[model samples]
Target: MSGRIPRQFIDDLLVRVDIVDLIDSHVPLKKTGSNFVARCPFHTEKTPSFSVSRGKQMYHCFGCGASGNAISFLMDYSHLGFVEAVEDLAAFVGVDVPREIGGDFSASDKEDFTRLYAVLEDVAAFYVDQLRTGDGRIAVDYLKARGVSGEVARDFGLGYAPQAWDVLLGRFERDALIDAGMLVVREDGKVYDRFRGRLMFPIRDKRKRVIGFGGRVLDDSLPKYLNSPETAIFSKGKELYGLCELLQKKSRPERILIVEGYMDVIALAQYGVANVVATLGTATSKTQIDMLFRYASELVFCFDGDNAGRQAAWKAVDAALSCLRDGRQIKIMLLPQGHDPDSLIRDEGKAGFEQRIEQAQVLSDYFFDFLAGPLNLSSIEGRSQLMTAARPQVEKIPPGYFKDMMWRRLRELAGSRVVELPEKPSTLNRQFQGKVGKAKTQRPSLGRRVLALLIQRPELAQVLAQRHLSLEGLKFAGQELLEDVLRRIALEKPENGAILLEAYRGSSYEKTVNALAGVELDIPEGGEEAEFFGAVIQLLKQSRQEKLTELLAKEGREGLNAEEKQVLRALLRERL
Candidate 1:
């Protein structure tokens, strides 16, 4: 609990948890050939683009470019953080995660957050208790008037704060409540409840643990929303209201709606629209947007159709551009004047509200439209102005089809004044243009093939060591990585690809090793050993040829030493 999870533990955990079994339990994989296949859970695809390799203990999505080991799969599929995902996997395999001596977490850091989470949970329970007790009827009646049902209220853990200042102060420890952001200490040496006479919305993380609270006054009051102060466990910019509830309703929603307030989220959910989350009194951050995309592919930011709403939506766009990928989408939906999501949902009903969602302007369209505000695009000067304003933001988009299409749209809008952009990289199309029609005649280099084969079946390392050959002087692009893999395989004797790659995690070779783990080698089944030895022999011979040529050149320049002469003689006698 004090330090990072030991790498050895993680490697062992990967060995215990079979990738095929783990993914099958979640995604219902079908055996297509040697590996299992499923429709990718990360994106919407008709074809089964997701593959789980039993031999490698890895999953890769051909359509969306999602690939990783078991820990990564949980992080994406369950929306859990890294530690949480590791813990989940460990629990599945019935092992406890061990911590190293020096890691990101200290003992106090671990204990403090544990206590903070517990105190927050207690505080939330106390507030929820207040909702059902005396004077709770006002809060309950307020919710009823807003058409919030009992079930939805309970589902979201809606609560109430009594008007008294000492309610929570007297119940929980002073220091713990203050640390939890429940009790505030003023400069005058007075402590009071942070939320009073308000409806409380407990903000929980993806793990469904309360981290903070958002309090809304029942009647019209200054500062209509008073949120929990930034604490160790809570950052308003990184948290979203109703997200845990949304995930509970559907583990993976087709689309997620973003609103401005807690009531909007609650009201929408009351109207049978369950896939909505609200920004907690701050502009949406990239962290929140990334978190949202983990649960849904599409996001609709629903704001009031006022100048302020447009301003907020624009800020969201600025935050979202960098997060755009091939399959992800962001849309902006501005409600009618004088109405927010709460009032609009009640007035228009669920069908009408969802219709607005479907009609929301896509981010690309909204982005250009927002940039073209009051600008005469027909005029050269105005088009030039648009190009200048949009170039930097457009470049923030990740390289993919989405970025390419956005560039195309910008060019069409800025026709004569288009700024020359870099030529699109050829690799951008590789994700979409998969190996559907390509012939299998192409093969990677011998070194690369050996690396791929070793990754797919780490036991091949033992087979390789049996040859009693050493690649001590071989020089190639991935020579160092190849040496490292063989060395790790010898030391740890990893049972599969996951355990073998775990040693390379967080190292410079992680991406290369993982890519090799997922590589589709074209060698015939049961021919891995022959191919492996054949490649090894060729590389050794190639290396010897280079050395022989070097020694002969050195002899012509200066006579060779005894060892060098013997090496040259041995190399000359061997068949090329």
Candidate 2:
């Protein structure tokens, strides 16, 4: 694991895990002509803007700017690092991920990840063994009482931590537990267990490695739930509980059910609701929502009818709205008074639960109706109040038809009084100001735009190279992306955008390549080519002239610095 995994291993893994099969598990791709089409999972929209090319083993979401290979998709969707994604794909195909491959692979991060994985595996096993015997029976009984079945419990790798603080501390090396975020050291340098006497719910990465844990207290305790602190392998914002199993099963659950606690997930799963996961006792994050897009196109956020749960659902809805794109959808489901998914499933059975799920409303619809319910729309002052409250929320939406829809709904709900709504200040102005301030502060030299022109037209590459245009000449900060393209062109001799992009596969510039490929290119012909070059030269001359004028005005005759004076004289001499 210390050495870099070989390129051949990655290639073999990709071959084993068919791109079409892997992508289909997350996206409901329907046959559209020769390729498959689904709503882009990356952005919000009603129409499909994402497509998969099986022949090329790639996917591109035209809506929210997500485009990548199968490996990248797994990494993005599952929140697995590159190595983990590769290893998982290899294991899925029943192939071994070799610890060492003969190559000069340069990613220290990958090495760190491998080590962390080994440590986490050891920790998960320890917890599982503890749950099988000893004080872990308390945890087992607790789950059973909550309506979690043995099969579901086994499926999720649920376990328990003993009452003793050092139960896990004694089993593993001190540094290992600390590194894995399983222990907290006090001021006296004595390390105590992070999760004691609680049912252990292993939070796994998409590759099926338990990266962290969510612990549920069996007894009536303050806090009731505790989760693994953030670690190199786990970020609460990025990982979801059941994604690994869902990905492997390749089942497109019609709808995804999001709950608040581990027991909620286990109980729902016990009742054959396989597409359920808990948020580890925190608010839903964008990463979690993005991960869900990989599996279910629609997500139903189920919470209790209590005020706290309703508030939680509101937050979840807001988060979901930000992450939604063309094909994906989200809904809010409030359980009956004083009931959560766990309690409802227990009292009324799976049928009762499914019936309520069927009635879940789309988030936007729910939000509008919920807001309307409390406010009186008939009164002018009430409408004004509603607009005042809703405008801020509307402004938070990224510019799109979704924003328009919200405004339209407001108009319908408030009628002519919609004008009373506050107008959002221009974000573009804010963004421009930010960019201008940054430019003034950094004053980064512009990278050569000439290289971009050359990459777009391979025929121009030789001309630019002949002119001694290297990446250093390109003063632009993002010139690295262009340099990557030029390097690809030099080595691959790509005749077209598609070929050029293919040559960049598995390279760091894959996303850049995809973006470049998406750009429409124009290759001038005959006189037009000459005219284009002439226009470019003229623009350069004009730019130089403008700079000289500015310098002359600012510094005058005696105010000119030596280097500037020399340059000015040279330019004057050239013009003369």
User: Pick by TM-score: which candidate is best?
Assistant: 1
In each prediction, how many residue pairs overlap at the backbone (N, C-alpha, C within less than 3 A)? 0, 16
Clashing residue pairs in candidate 1 are none
Error of 2 at 474 (Å): 26
Where does candidate 2 have its weakest 10-residue lDDT segment?
432-441
Per-model CA lDDT versus the true structure: 0.83, 0.68
lDDT of 1: 0.83
TM-score of each: 0.81, 0.63
